[model samples]
Target: MSNMQHELQHLPASAGLEARTVGRVGIVGASSTGIGIAIQLLDAGVPVTFYEADAAALGAGLAQIRSAWTDTHDSRLALLAGTINFHHLKDADLVVDASETEGGEALFRRLDQTTKPGAILATAAAGAGVDRLAGATRRHGEVLGLRVDRAQVWELVPGRDTSDPTLATVGALARRLHAPAAARR
Candidate 1:
């Protein structure tokens, strides 16, 4: 067998399975940040679903995403990368909020009522009051904040309820995304 095949044979069963399983990711916004993240996730072989509140905004975001890909290539081959959407957040294993507008609060409230009980919810907002947002939506234990600046990422857990299992899952996902963890404060 080839060296590649030999290496695959020695991989753990879970590792082998994970290599074949495509992860589903949901982004609650379709703005620049959201679409950028979706592109990264797609590059990592994850399927993406985007939810946007405005139809015009969604169209704009899609155009921007396509433009970015096209700008980097001749025929815009990345257009065929993965799936994307502009409405509805349904049955997603992981959901990320990339909007810093009041929409973030509204999205969290809707997610609290609609998302699966154990689904992971994350935010890229640096200074947004994640704990307060969670408390307002009655999801204090389920929300996690991710801070990203200059390519450095940190996970922020609320001090009041930092030991929740959901936080651990979020941390694991962050690790999978190659993000570093920060202490809760």
Candidate 2:
């Protein structure tokens, strides 16, 4: 069995549910940041779906993942998927937008409409970008910024309207991935 399967097997049913509150993470962009975050999530037994506007970029991202991962078990690999369809992210509990595409405001607005209600929306963009992105979404309370540093620590940056519960949920996810979290206003 793969390491991910072994880890999942040791987890109780309740533990699984609790830890996976942000189940099935979706990442926008096939950028290096997106790929790195995908690796971290997959290593933690979290299913990851990647959305890329460019088909070629999506293919390249998948290739990068396969090449970087030493443990290429089919079962563990099954947890990763790629899509060009924006709607495919509807089922994702958390979405981290790492794309450097144009019209970021439009994209965030689309994400607000496409993602399921209560789904946590995050951006890998720096500075007050999260606040700007949140302004495009109706679900301001559920939107924040997330990025993994070189130390593998997750930095959770909140917008003006970000809620405590949203931070808690993402914090739980960081812990599940065996990464510490730093909160930033």
Best by TM-score: 2
What is the Cα-based lDDT of residue 175 in candidate 2?
Answer: 70
> After aligning candidate 2 to the native by TM-score, how far in Å is the CA of 66 from where it should be?
1.2
Q: Which ten residues in a row have the lowest lDDT in candidate 1?
A: 11-20
CA lDDT, every model vs. true structure: 0.58, 0.81
lDDT of 2 by residue, 82-128 (tens): 99999999999999988866437788899889989989889886653
Please give, for residues 64-93, the per-residue lDDT of candidate 1 as tens digits.
666755456634334232233333456666
Clashes of 2: 0
Native-vs-model 1 lDDT?
A: 0.58
